[model samples]
Target: MLTIDINKQLGDLDLQVNAQIPMQGICAIFGRSGAGKTSLVNILGGLSTPDNGQLTLGATHLYHQQQKINLPPERRRIGYVFQEARLFPHYSVRGNLNYGNKDKDQVHFDTVVGLLGLTELLNRYPATLSGGEKQRVAIGRALLTRPQMLLMDEPLAALDLPRKRELIPYLLQLAKTLNLPIIYVSHSLDEILQLADSMLVLDKGKVLVNGPLHAVWDSAEMRPWLPVKEQSSLLMATITELNQKYRMSKLSLADGTYLWINGMPLPTDSKLRVRIHANHVSVCINRPTDSSIRNILSSTIAEIIHSESNDNVQVKLAFGDDHIWANITPWACDDLALKVGQAVYAQIKGVSMTESELAQSF
Candidate 1:
């Protein structure tokens, strides 16, 4: 188990975090830029000293005030991948990788090279590599350290949208191959969905939520810093069918099949993710006549929460075990006579690709 209990002050806000993460899968540290997300991560990495508290991984004591124990960053055997790909500018990819291991051990080198697909670019200098390539090397270097845990501090932030797209899959693969837990810090919800298994939601130096991404994001804006156009809830679904020739994939949800504008990521009869935004779903009393919308799931209303800043109400609808939040105008809710337990069809309108997502095996 990875346990954390911390208290720190950054300017005006006070951060108090006490949480535990299972020693498996990625546990993303998610929040706004100044939410003290990075600070918490730094403390975990031994890069910053916490004012008070204790931290431990399995049996190793990383920090403790009462015990007066604090392990230095180097001795912690933790790997850190910073926002910038901090590769040695003068060294070739191979050299930078070789520097990760203290003894230049044969075991770590070949493993990291093969795992990160670095063999082809071994001779290339850091200056010659693309942003994605540099980041890939950075990851390989991190793996070669043979660390107990990995710390990623917005490792994709410097990369452009396209570069981020190119790198996410490889990072996901890294998470799966290495059993070591990762403390990933980022504000990007898509990145969290693509990689993290759980999250520690922080804001203004305080933790607001900490749990599985699915549980923490239920009908809430999990990360508001994400582009206003793309903020939404993510649902895990299975691949029901693939129409690759037409470039569309059908996903199986508890409610029904959700068709997305992409190829399927997982194999046939495998599970994938389908992101549905509150604004994208239109609530209707009856299934409307044929239209461009390909998804129409019948569900019962669970609850309706009004948006404080607008006339819209967030309608939570349950489909079997899954629930989707749809934002509808209060006036429209009145017109349709919506209420708890009301039968409704969540109409998914105008589906298109904003992220250059390729359906890789999740």
Candidate 2:
């Protein structure tokens, strides 16, 4: 595990954080602009010093205030990828990738090349590569350093939607294949949801919430930061069967509710996490008949949250141990008289159950 207890003052912001981040998979540092997301990662990367704190990664002590030990950036053995690619324009991709290397035995040159899909662009100059291509090369260069941990600060921020889509799969592959820990920093919820295994949310330089992605998703603290229309619940499911005739796949949820989704083919028995958006779900006093909606599960109203605008209410539904959220108008909520522990049917359309980019397979 990576332990951190640090305090720093940057201009008017007094940053303070105390949390234990897991050292396996991707741990995302998430917050809005000026939430000290970058500052915290900078401290972890040895790019900046904390006023007073202790930091330990595995058996190494990267920083200790009492002992006055602060390792230099290079000595920390942490790879960093910033918002920009930051590649050397004067050199070809191959030359830039080999610039800093003393332990060539640790990583194979061709392996890194193929992992980032840079085999075709090895001889191309930085100017000739697209934004996504340059970032891929940058990632390859970082991996070639053989760092113990990787720090990424919105690495996809500069890319357009298509470029971001193209790059996400590569990152997911890296997360699954690489044994090294990754600390990803981003303000975008979509990116965090898709890439992070655990999350550390910051608000005004303080650690608001830090824990596994699923746990944080259900926390009340996270609701305020999420857009009401974008609020959704994550469910872990397994692909049981695929209907080639309908171009849809059947997923078995933990509650034994089978949900169908239309998309690219996924391997059978592959575990996936799906997002059921609040806007796509509607509450019914009783199960409906002859409806176009494909999923209608019996659920209990566990909690109801009135929107700050007073225009809508977010109802939390419980089905077994799993929970889903539904956003309905206040009038509808009053008309139905929803209360805690009230039985209600949740209608979810098949098209509404999207294959999230954030879903992970085990």
Report the number of the highest-TM-score candidate: 2
> In model 2, where is the ten-residue run with the lowest total lDDT?
353-362
- Each candidate structure's count of clashing pairs: 0, 1
Cα lDDT, model 1, residue 155: 91
Q: Please, what are the lDDT tens digits per residue for candidate 1 over residues 240-317?
A: 777878766677766664655554445677765556777788888998777678777888999887666666677888
TM-score of each: 0.90, 0.95
User: For candidate 2, lDDT tens digit of each residue in 185-227?
Assistant: 9988788777888899999999999999888875889886778
Could you tell me which residue pairs clash in candidate 2? Answer: 194-358
Model 2 scores a C-alpha lDDT of 0.87
Error of 2 at 254 (Å): 0.8
C-alpha RMSD of candidate 1: 2.6
